[model samples]
Target: MATEEKTLVEILEENNLIDLAKYVNYVSASQAGAIATFSGTTRDTFEGKTVVELRYEAYVPMAIRQMKSICSSARSSWDIHSIAVAHRLGTVPVGEMSVFIAVSAVHRADALDACKYLIDELKASVPIWKKEVYSNGEVWKENSEFMDRKLELGKTNGSCCRRNVKVETHGTKSCCGAKVKVADGAAAEISTSDAGTEETI
Candidate 1:
């Protein structure tokens, strides 16, 4: 007789608050010897600026799809038993939890490594946006991991802005008749004249 495979993958989006314990408990199992978790809390400050709160927005369908992909990727790389991921949208006050991740495996190493990879990949690829509200102003934030992936995609597919342009070490100035500006060695903004749209990458 063959034993059944036990696997759990949950991707959740909540407007209210998130309970970390729920995720930890969900990943716990009899066969799992180790469980690892990550809790992301909103801080009170950023770069010496006082942060009032953080507001998160996501393309719900795409976010969930990407999260599922990430979980599948983790399972392929490690012998993970389960994975639980929860992200809170809307307003999250200072010191409040914004995201939580939990992973379980038969060994400590697999659980720990998979937990880290899940969060990192989620932040890098998920279609989630964060708005940091400071005492004086508010700004949208982007993760470096996402930016790096964008650059990598541009290099690999050669479809940046649907044009084949030379990618500079610092930045690509034009793509599909759009001007791209990379700030501080990171691609920060892209503007297109045809669409009259400006976006932050």
Candidate 2:
């Protein structure tokens, strides 16, 4: 099976704000009237304690799937021409860019909205987990307090797993109507009846 690879905008090194800005600029070219960017950096404090560094790990395939889904959704919802999202794994120091999201659009509103949505969805859905290595101790914090709050507020939404789902492509009743049923059994059977009343299985 082919697996999706992971990519990081910056390697696990010292913080470089200029590189982040340059990446954003690279993604957002002169064709776009507005460019929206969101950069998440390591914080100096966590849970009222001083923090030093953070180690991030991810299920590479799943993380890539989630990111691609985010980009697809943004493209469908907003009039955006380009989008780039990159998150770092491995050790990240305090005040270093952990994730970067950039979106470009013909107008500012769609770009900004899509950028914010991309970041929020990435935080909530992406499988990248972070271990906060405090100056005192080490603790794995998958989602931050803000993410927890968002979850509590019921703002997180998206599909994170691959499940069988029936998708309607157009508003028209397919210009036709067809029904397919999958029965649950030891050897499940999927029955499909087409609009032409033909059954070939």
Candidate 3:
């Protein structure tokens, strides 16, 4: 069971750039000609205004599962050696890293290509969402960018949801106790037995 699952999923409460680079170093071997890594960070400004901080939220389980699936998919599609992906959550200030993707292969071309695809697919299919906070207001980045490609892949693969995991309308309580509603009804309510009330999904 453990072997079937990728061991790269991690919760990064701190900076991702360093850890990501570290992971990249760890995954790359001498057998590989090249190792590629991409890191995304919060900029001080966007569209001509000073940016403050950014908040990221994700459907945790689904996001991690999707990342693993992506790595597996890339491995199948390309001649990749090893892959590691890490994304940061919670409040991130300007210049803080947001996401990291790395891929190593025997050839530089495959490594670069797979790395690009990994980041693009991560942005498009993975269930992670980011909120950009600016001086004036905040905006939620569209989740639609990844939907079409994911659906197409689902059709090719027969389904998007992995085995034993069904996509439905569900809500999840965040680590901070905030409830996030899922349109697919696949989320579940998480509450402690000692709590006064059970949070609704």
lDDT of 3: 0.62
State which candidate, 2 or 3, has the greater lDDT.
3
Q: Which regions of candidate 3 are displaced past 4 Å?
A: 1-7, 14-18, 147-201
lDDT by residue (1-201, candidate 1, tens digit) is 222334433333333567677667777888888999998999999989898887676544455556777888899999988787877666678999888888889899999999999999988888676777777666666555766786777744422222221222322221112122234321222222332222211
Better of 1 and 3 by TM-score: 1
Q: lDDT value for candidate 1? A: 0.65
* Residue pairs with backbone atoms closer than 3 Å in model 1 (clashes): none
lDDT by residue (tens digit), candidate 3, 126-149: 766666666766665544555566
- Candidate 2 lDDT tens digits, 1-201: 221212222222222232566556555656678878898988999879887777666544456555777788787898886776766666677878788877778799998999999898888777666766666566656476435645676756523222222332223111112222223341132212221111111
Q: After superposition, how far is residue 42 of candidate 2 from its true place, in Å?
A: 0.3
Error at 105, model 2, angstroms: 0.5
Index of the highest-lDDT prediction: 1
> Cα RMSD (Å) per model?
12.2, 17.3, 9.8
